[model samples]
Target chain A: MTALPKPQTLSLTVNSKPVSMPVPQGVSMQEFLHEWLGLTGARMGCGQGICNACTVMVEEPGKLPREVRTCITGAHWFEGKTVRTVEGHARQNADGSLTLSPVQQAFVEGFAFQCGYCTPGFVTAATVLIERLRAAPVPREAVERVVSEALDPHICRCTGYVRYHTAVRDLVLATPGLVTA
Target chain B: MRTFLLTLAGLAIGGTALAGLVFSGALNRSVVSRTVETPLTAEQIKALAPQGAKVAAAADCYACHTARGGAPWAGGMPFETPFGVIHATNISPSREGIGGWSRAEFHRALRDGIAPGGRHLYPAMPYTSYRGMTEGDVDALFAYMTTRTPMPVGNAKNGLAFPFDQRWTLAAWNFLNLPASVAEPNPERSELWNRGRYVTEALGHCGECHTPRDLTQGLRTSKALTGAVIEGLEAPDITPAGLTHMGFSAASLATFMGSGLSAQGAATHQMFDVVHFSTRHMDRADLLAMAAYFFDRDALTDEAPAVLPEPAPVAADVAARAQATYAGLCAGCHGAMGEGIPHVSVAMRGNASLRTASPSGFVRAVLAGLPAQSFPDGERMEAMPSFAADLDDAAMADLTNWMRAEWGGQAPTVQTRDVAAVRATLTTRHAAGD
Candidate 1:
């Protein structure tokens, strides 16, 4: 067997909470999420980056949101990048009521998922889409086209994107200032 | 006269003997007893409503049983077969429908393809797939269907050719072609696998299109779900082996079922049925279980996925001339590079929708503008504008070839005649009020 690299300590923010941990070189982010962090939301569909099921939001202070696939990439590669995941979409209020993000709420109301294994990726991707649209508002008429282009990379088997499209459109329309006619 | 009579008797006896010997198993197979503990009252039915609805959606009865823009479960869908055209029967609770059906009668029709009063149903009803459904699910389906409001929608008359008009022939066809209705879950498998098998093989009825059929029109078991061509459209192999080659994982398949995009652009054509109906309504756990079961099956050995060749470049003359046509007629929404403005226009580059060996979809989009879709929630979805008057057959072929070749990764050129053929078919279909 090839000699393994020395373990290194890494620090990063996950779903807004900062944490540091020792990581082995070349440990796939997908394995770490499932095995170590116990976050089973990011599913491994193709193991390769093609499916994009393992997509997570890579957030840096001022940069545009980036969707990264954890399946193939090394965990150590993201030494200090802030990441957002599906679990982070809903927050528990002081009264103990959980408030879901707009995208997640839209998905639920639209019946956007059947098996829902891909729901996390779609949620994350749509979240990125909302962020992108906010950064550069497009023509209101371009809602369908813009959303389609943004989430084009994620794979889904059910609803044919009909429900997903409706959900995102509802979000864009419901959340004012995201688009201008 | 005596000798001739003797010869005729011998031939008749021999033929009957042959049929009896060949069809003994099917003819003798035992059907489940359609027993009811008690007549279900409306209150009792109300309790079973949730389960009933789940079963109805699982069987996809509405897809074939209901008419377009017609009352729910009021059959008016027309199906064309080589033998003739047959309309789906009404199964609602009206006098014109199945309002008076008993539980036993419903079970008989579902498992034995025998309707009330001993009427044999046509094989076109996909009773073969339904035969795999367990007794519990069949009961659920019966409750749901029988509970629908009885509409007075008259049934469409079937026009089958000669011998096919006789319903008795269907009995022989069923015996010869269909598996026995009894299903036994594998003792070696887990509950999840059994559920997966039941959903995929029965409720989903995916093999109707996904499985290649033999000359006799029965599923070819050897290559089930490997792929089958339906209505000249490709229902590509969805088997684990086929999917693995495409780099699809369980999660990917689940994603595909949930959203319809798979790294590529969209899942068009018949895949829409599964996405919009069966898989989309299924629970998340069910989808995950299905993916797990599919991946674990021994149906195929892992093979390297087919390598899509890099598309060849377009001819300069075609490209040069088509560029102007594209810029003037197509580029506004599709983008100058054929990359398409997301949501505003579908990207042409790397899009499977435009790169298919079949050009019919592309032709339809151009000739008749894609109509804006109205979702159930009253949302007006995007629409693609038409170029019917602006682009003739020659212009269509030129533009298609250039766009596909330039951005769709070396797609083959389309001929004007092909465009004409598609237009002709579309016109015929529309004229027939399809």
Candidate 2:
């Protein structure tokens, strides 16, 4: 029988909290999130990076938050980096209630999802776009093109892309400073 | 905006001055004006038109003359030059094209770079190489062109600036750059070798892209086939010695030319068009002849290097980070051991880009990524997503070094600066509207 490789320490920030865990070599980010961290929100669709269904936000200091495909990328690759899964999009109130993010609320109001398997990926993409706009806002005239480019990668099997796209566009247009008038 | 205007003014003045100098220097020189005879019989046209089609394919006329999603030979495709944009002219047999053109006029255009009106053509037409075309072949090509469906698409006007738009100045440019006489067939070399040479140098005009250009933007004949950079990618040295060093045998080169894939890797970037538009359509014999000319051998040499050298050890930290990055991003498709997923991605071991000393090709592939590509044999590779935004320069350099070390048997010599340079080139190309 072949001897298995030993686990390595992975230190990173998950959501708003710091995490230091021993993860086995070559364990995917999707596996680590669902099994060890219990963040099952990032559903794996194709298991390859093609569908972008397991998309998660990766943030670095002095850099814009970017989407990293968790199904294909190894968990160890996110070591020492800050990660945000779909669960991190909402806030917990003092009364032990959940307050949905602006994008999440817009998604619900716009009826953006059907079966909701691909909703997390859509949410992550939209959230990152909002953050990016907060830093560097685009002109109002360019809002549709910008929104399309942001949401172009994620694949929705339920064919709910039009609603999802409309929700994101609406959120950006409604939010001040996201799109310059 | 002021700087741009100033630069434009300076360019106009400089170009005019150069044109003035050239015009004065060639005052006594005369253009090729000998009238050619058109004596093709109906039977001869029948015999020659198909052969002409093959010759046109070998010359890669379709790629330049045909616009994307447009009629095959109706033109309007734009070639971006250092001076300005030049659109390919309509070559179909419509009234808007060559409907009234005679055989002699067609020959003159191909051989002397002169149109029906004695207008001088820009060197972007690659007439320097085509000037060596055989009279019989030219007639055949003319016949084949006449048989094309006559689309009524008019030619777009050339968008060259002042001095370049002055077509008369091309006489001077030609005097300096054009060959004094056509290349004669060598009696000493084998018929196959000579045929290959004609196909490669005369019809194909391979050196127009592969050979480095001099100050005049004329191909450096002294270092022909030694490779040149086009746009942002290195065309790489294709000299006989270079091919041998890259482990390309005659058989392999022929296969690569005909199919666009080999043990080394698929035809990439600019070379992709060469295979897709020209070589893949060429007859197998012509492809083999081209391989013979490139390898300088008449017989088939089927051998290719079977093994790569073992990778040397690198710093532990560098190796670790690179491995993790690869596992995260590249390993899924390229395979855990760099074996590559069959028909999806190529193996890294004998990849020609990695084997080269320069990392520009490899770096560009990673940053820009390749679109899902098809082969002549109906095989295809999946699209590779670009990581230009996701990976930093340092991380890119690390990944390149690791891949080179592990599979290419190369040193960990690629640096962050090198990646930065490649990235800058891509940005520059994008700005230039490539």
Candidate 3:
């Protein structure tokens, strides 16, 4: 048997909390988030980069946003970085009650999921889409194109696509002054 | 020892240098140096190319085109079907490929079903779905192919036997069947809906396998997304009812397309192939658009209208003939009503197994006795009997046809030749597997 390398201690921000964990040499961001931290927001579908179920945003201090697939990406790649996941979308109020993010609310209201397996991935992707659309509201015709382009990496098998489309459309329309009637 | 180490280091350095040379294109020149290859300037290639041609090339048009060799687009790659094999032709610049083809002819070949030679290219080329591609995209695909390093090769001969090999018969087949002409997206629908329809119906070609086929192997448009068996496993209905059957929502469908998994079930087999090839690259919005169309489309209300209903009570003469054959051959195991004996035989009537798309299976079941199995419960079941020596093709066809007509359910006729062809192919497949 080959002698395995010693585990490395790493610190990273997940859902805004700085957490430390022992990461193996080839551990992926998704595995770390899911197995070690118990954050099941990022799904594991096709471990290859093809499926976007493991997509997560790496927040850097001053660089352009980069979306990485946690499944294929190594945990070491997230060292000293803040990663946002579906869990980060909700907030706890002063009274200890949680409020759903607009994107998450839109998904529920739009009836976006049937089996709910691919729901988290879609939510994560929609969060990213909403952020990008806020920076620059796209034309109504371009919304579908942009959303498709943005979510091209994720896969869903149920509901076909109507509800997901409606979810994104609702999110975009709800954004203040972003979408004109 | 020192000298050996030094020599090893030198060899490693040389290998890295050689790899760099190959990576940088220096080795490319040496490899092609002896070939009569006149390199065209990038500008020249671009100028001569039609729009969207480059994209088509990237889509791996050559993978199928150059399989057998000929002019590109001449058609001759063998695409295996449940019925038989269909070959793709060479789509080249030669007269056989597209040499004499006009722009309109080329457009028809790409977007329409008409070939330059006025023949209808089989749906195997996916022109049925490719028809939805914008004129610009089609133009680019044409330009890209014409500009390729044209190789002189002949079209591969089709492997189909008589009756199946008749190309002229395809014309009538196309007229009677084939998908409808591509229609522009309705402006009344959302932009997302339009784009989704464009990608799914055209570039994605989801229906090729998902949609059920008629007797002639053409897509049954009226029963779109109802369900069909492709390759071997059933392509589940993506229609709302089918979705409901599987308990998948519109969002779940989009997610599955985007990621190849849902909470309900992970994609397996041919679906995995589809997800990897097509859905993986589709954007979420486009996936949603496809989902939208699928969910909103009407359910398959028209039951296979072509299939005749079950024949009334078997004719007395036919019953007597069938009874004699059944008693002498089958009654020992299968009970009198065709209700198979428990732990001994499989019922012929109302059995899903008998009503499958390929009648060849039933023929095989009859020709080869069913194999015995030892169940976990310790119950032993007898194998089905083989009738190859006992029954001819006509008898087998008649029996199975009667079984379908009498006991199985409403389905179209199964020709004797269809049974024969399936038998031959099954033997070949079984031999290959061994």
Candidate 4:
């Protein structure tokens, strides 16, 4: 005869679009993004959040975007928050064609990833690193160490570390105000 | 490379370079080390090292350590990693190998990631997982490794890139990634389950392949043992979260691990190495425990049964090529419609290899024959013969792509390039005596 608790409405802004839906209890953010939104780019490499294969970006006003692992994260935790997934990393042209983000472009040109399951997470992680570095640039000699330290958390089993670092280094060097020598 | 070899040789000789001695595998018997007084007796190796031998074989250390066409555990195998190609060090009981090291040194290397002279070894050696190993187990593995005939072949220098070429980077990597915490027995789980967890995670280094890594090559702790793409091949999700879940039950998984076959026809590619070198040799009890641990850790309750896919009929062009190849080379045993001729050919239609995103397994199977020793239920079966030298890359692709459509049903047709690439790998491994 006890009253049941009401199901709370899960709300979030993903890739500049607002979403409000009644999220299932016990469903993870990974499950929500994949099952509810049909955005499968945030992969579930290890459901435990150890691999960061399911990494996503969460942005707040006047603050640097942070990398969030969607796999182990709660859907309810994203309530009224802003998150960006791998799918949103690209811009759509007027004709509906997608233009890859600079990070994604760097990945592609450098052939940074292999078997790319880890690529989405790497893409998201590298994007945030790039943005953070943009706001505060570092010396060029420190560039290699900075990029290596930044991208150290994302795992690529293809052992694509050299390629990924190479791409990130090139991107930082090429981009204005991102890094200095 | 020469400097590294000299350093090792110097270390073996207690900082003194021996005169008039040629240190190489080819002349090892004739040019004995000045340090060693006598060779290890056979009785010494066999009498005291049964448990050590068992652990060593199950760990499959020789598979990775043996260099191309070298003697077993001779240790010159080159591992191609992201940083560069690193070579396996000689683990043989020789002055040039780990023979000179004490148990403490070996334990430190395996358990603490600290090698001789306090240098931190790279993660490639997989000490991170080995760190989880019990002291007794590490002792056993060391006992077996030290018994191997010491070959004088020095490990070749790795092709590691800048920063990574520096060992200090790896030391930093270890600080972050090293699982300093011990894997204690889960009080809730059975002894068998705990044993399986230890063997699978630590001895087997299954996570090295199955679990995805973080930016620093550290395992992302949150999503453990789910699945990851390993070197282009999809090491499918052993966890229930995977879209196409591992359909085998605990018993079936055990059977598969033991014999390299489950409900699925064959275990192909690198998985073959695992079965051949490690799991196939394991006792049934251990295999069962491994299966149990996987099921329990994966928490696969209420998993949806894998609905077998119904593939559309093969396309005309692909069918023509496939049918032609199958008729001539494969149909005698494999059957006209890909249905297996029992005790002879494993059916391709429902085989797991065909359904993978990459057809490397099937290509590997074709290149290197699936031996009779790998069959489940302990019943010997006729093996698929090698067609590496016989089949062209294009033909292999056509046959594989057709099988994907005809039998696998849901998989996409393969390209000639995929076939060629896999074939190239097979050729290399074959040359390496895989």
Report the error of model 2 at residue B112, Å. 1.9
Rank candidates, TM-score, best first. Answer: 2, 1, 4, 3
- Tens digit of lDDT per residue, candidate 4, span B1-434? 99999988877784222212322112111111222233335565455477887787667787788865897777778877766788888888887788778767777787767777866577888888887777667666766787677888777788988868866445446656775476888888778878889888888888887788888878876878776766656576665333243345666677788888766665665677788778888888788778778877533234454455687576688777676566545654565567766655577766667765557767877766665544545554454556675468888888887877777774555788887777666655343221
Off-target runs (Cα >4 Å) in candidate 3 are: A1-181, B1-77, B92-102, B148-153, B179-181, B261-266, B297-434
Q: Compared with the true structure, what per-residue lDDT tens digits does model 2 show for residues B196-306?
A: 999999999999988999877888999999888777677888888777555566888888899988887788777888888999999999998888888887655557544
Tens digits of per-residue lDDT, candidate 1, B14-123, equal 66775665445345342646355356677766677678788777677877778878888899888877678899988888988888888777777887778888677887
RMSD of candidates 1 onward, in order: 18.8, 5.3, 27.0, 22.5
By summed lDDT, which 10 consecutive residues of candidate 3 chain B come out lowest? B27-36
Between candidates 2 and 4, which one is better according to DockQ?
A: 2
**Two-chain DockQ for each candidate model:** 0.01, 0.43, 0.01, 0.01
Best by TM-score: 2
By lDDT: ranked, best first: 2, 4, 1, 3
Q: How close is chain A of candidate 3 to the true chain A, as a TM-score?
A: 0.90
Evaluated at residue A38, the lDDT of candidate 1 is: 86
* Model 4, span A1-181: residue lDDT tens: 6444345588899888999988654467888898889999998885544578998998889877878767545577677789999999999999999999999999999999989989998898889889988898998898898788768877888999999999988998899988865
User: Which candidate comes out best when scored by DockQ?
Assistant: 2
Report the lDDT tens digits of candidate 1 across residue range A31-137: 77787788889998866455678888888787678677777556765668898878888988999999988898898888898999888899989998889778888
Q: What is the lDDT of residue B3 in candidate 1?
A: 95
Candidate 1 error regions (>4 Å): A1-181, B1-44, B181-194, B241-252, B259-263, B266-274, B291-329, B337-345, B354-369, B374-381, B385-424, B428-434
TM-score pick, better of 1 and 4: 1
Single-chain TM-score of chain A, each candidate: 0.94, 0.97, 0.90, 0.94
Output the worst ten-in-a-row residue range by lDDT, candidate 1 chain B: B372-381
